[model samples]
Target chain A: MSASLPSTSPFPFPRFYNFPPFFSRQPTLQTHHSQLRKWSTLILNYCRHHRIFKLSLIDALDTELLYNKSLDKRMGIGEVREVVEFMRKEGRAEWAGEGGKGVGGNEVWIWWRNPEEWASLFYEWVDDTAQKHTVLTLYELTESEATISQEFHGMDPDLLQKALSILVKRGKAQVFGQEDQQGVKFF
Target chain B: MSRKGVGLAAFDRSRITSAQYASHGNSLRSSHSTSVATQLSVFRSLLQQFAQTHAKDIRSNPSFRAEFARMCAAIGVDPLASSSGAGGKDGGGSFWAQMLGGSVNDFYFELAVRVVEVCGASREENGGLIGVKEVKDRIMSTRMEGSSEITDDDILRAVNTLKPLGSSYSTLTVGPKIYIRSVPKELNIDQSAVLEAAQVLGYVTVSMLMINLKWPRARAKTAIDDLVSESMLWVDMQCAEWEYWSPGFMLGTGDDG
Candidate 1:
């Protein structure tokens, strides 16, 4: 089932998206590799366009990202898994589970921007706003009206923490408080 | 009696007249060659002047460039012929490199490089075979707006310019369409036939091939299998009958997507 996205403009799919055979897994090794590459790019772009942080493969199977409704062709679940596995190797995706052991998991974190990139964005925003020394609760940083216009606004809390941990390790920020109510102070 | 003693004198007169005729012929031959050389020099200067004036058009205008190349061909001048060995008049480089200051030659060379890049990028997908139009589209799409347009003719000429390097790039005709094949692979008659049939609807089934080409089921299957192995065709198994598709169709039929 496709996500009921905002009534914004639909994604402009690449020309190959309309090619019927793109839905099927190519038998040739080279062709299949190329197909996977295209799929990976398309998936990343689609998620970014929709502001999708994590993807459920089964849910996306019927979406335009993996299905060509006009041609009545859809990528099979195994093929989708293969493409996700390819993206995992490229470091653009990760299976959504603890300890990176989500083998055969149906959920994936499509890293349109990796956690490090998200960390830099957060640091830049804090620096630009001159809020360097001010303590900001994790909830305030992601859900505050002040960050409404920011790209990281309403980000998933776990992913935001992962990003914040990078800044913490770098000594650019300090995190203190309970796990559910942590606060951050950037320097 | 006095006239009868003139036989030796007559022979001497005949010899003198023959000597005069030989000298006159020599002078005439020398003058004719000089005049021909002058005409040739005049023509060369005129061509040079024309090329100098229209250098920009030759580089930017596709038809104008084609016509200019045709004129050179008509005059038995190879504009792209490198001047290194046979014709040492220019010392080194091609005729175009010498006359129009290499703009025209550079244009083709640049286009050839783009062609090679496009072919290399898509080699894994199409198995090193791509439609000439597809190559042009790929190149043009990456170009900025208001850039000069490229035609299929220019693409073909660009491929020809790659011959000196002994590249595997060459053009082949399959069913009414011309393709630039960058690999050294050869397709048998049956594979070509299947490919040609696939052009009709972007795909071909064994039954379709069997019915249309009067091929037995085994023969059609073998041809399709051969193409799939070459990566030239992708098989769609979701259909009622497995459909073999031409990868070239990926570029042709998806504009609305």
Candidate 2:
């Protein structure tokens, strides 16, 4: 979904996105640090709108994704790897590998917003609905929900469910499975 | 006279003239002490004036800072303390080290550069060779207590280094207090460059440049020889003097031995 965003550049140098330094990790602290901050902001915004919770390092290297002539931007393997590593450090994503082995050459979640943040966002969405004690189906909580739409803005229903699971861990909500449907009982 | 009479006579002189003599001698002694004190006071005030005016150039350049530090240390004052007082701010070794090419103890060459850089601008103000005494006084002010034994030759070496590739200057001898024929100002270049280069090279000789030019060998030789005879290119080491002859130049002590 992000790759298909109309091939337009919002940054000052529409061609700068294609610059090698844009993708390569910088070593100098004074220069590289600000670059990292920009990258983090760009990725986080992209993730929130797309509801992109997971990003595969392999998939990011897909020629269609990074090297499409339409956007004219391509990231090397190392750059893709570095961006994902940066995301992981911010707790916005993690490896889905077996016993953390996936950290090396791992697939990552693009938690443009971390689960904790998403959980809080979910709480706000639930409160705005003014249905504080009501239980709602995961599908109902995400799709056609007025407050959820306002907050997540077309967030994937599945990723929304994952975000709610984080809230469940914090005793902010309870989840129950009945038949083939799951429901959230919010505090 | 007998011992008693001599004593009586001495007492009588004390009554009539001893007080006057004592007062006169005391006043002369006091004035003499005041003059010595005044010399020291004036010298110190002059140092403070110099340091205040030139400390920035002296401390900012690597070569100057090191040489200045060495000069301070040579006179037995701590470089750090003197620099801080002169700097009038929080001073650090890093500041000195950076200006002095990374370390304080690099060698006399580095110190020479620092000295040259620091003094280069001030050279004009001091009247070049004519102001050698000012330079000497500036250097001497840093001498340690109980060790005011710096020689005129040592001071001359410092001053001669300031004489450019072609220049002359005068210096006074300590013993006879005579103005010996010091490096005369006929070489035609500034002394600051010479001093700076000498400080770096430890010693340097001025000779005709070997580069091919329109001048004939004889003319160049005569020109260089004339300059040398006029005491223009003076080096502390007498051996470092030369004359250019066409393809090459001759280097040796020219029997001023």
Which candidate gets the maximum lDDT versus the true structure?
A: 1
Residue A23 lDDT in candidate 1: 91
Q: Point out where model 2 deviates above 4 Å.
A: A1-20, A25-34, A62-65, A68-73, A97-101, A145-148, A153-158, A178-180, B1-257
- Model 1, span A1-187: residue lDDT tens: 1332332688888889988889999989999999999999999988877778889999999988888889999998999999999999999999988876896799998998999999999999999999999999999998888886776777888789889999999999999999788899999
lDDT of 2 by residue, A1-187 (tens): 2343322353222222333334444433433443455566666665544455566666656634444354344566776666667767877667655644687665666776666787897798678768778988776766553434354545555567678889888888998987448888889
Best by DockQ: 1
The lDDT of each candidate is: 0.88, 0.48
What does candidate 2 score on TM? Answer: 0.36
TM-score quality measure for candidate 1: 0.87
Report the lDDT of model 2 for residue A41.
62
**Pairs in steric clash, model 1:** none
Model 1 docking tier (incorrect/acceptable/medium/high): medium
Best by TM-score: 1
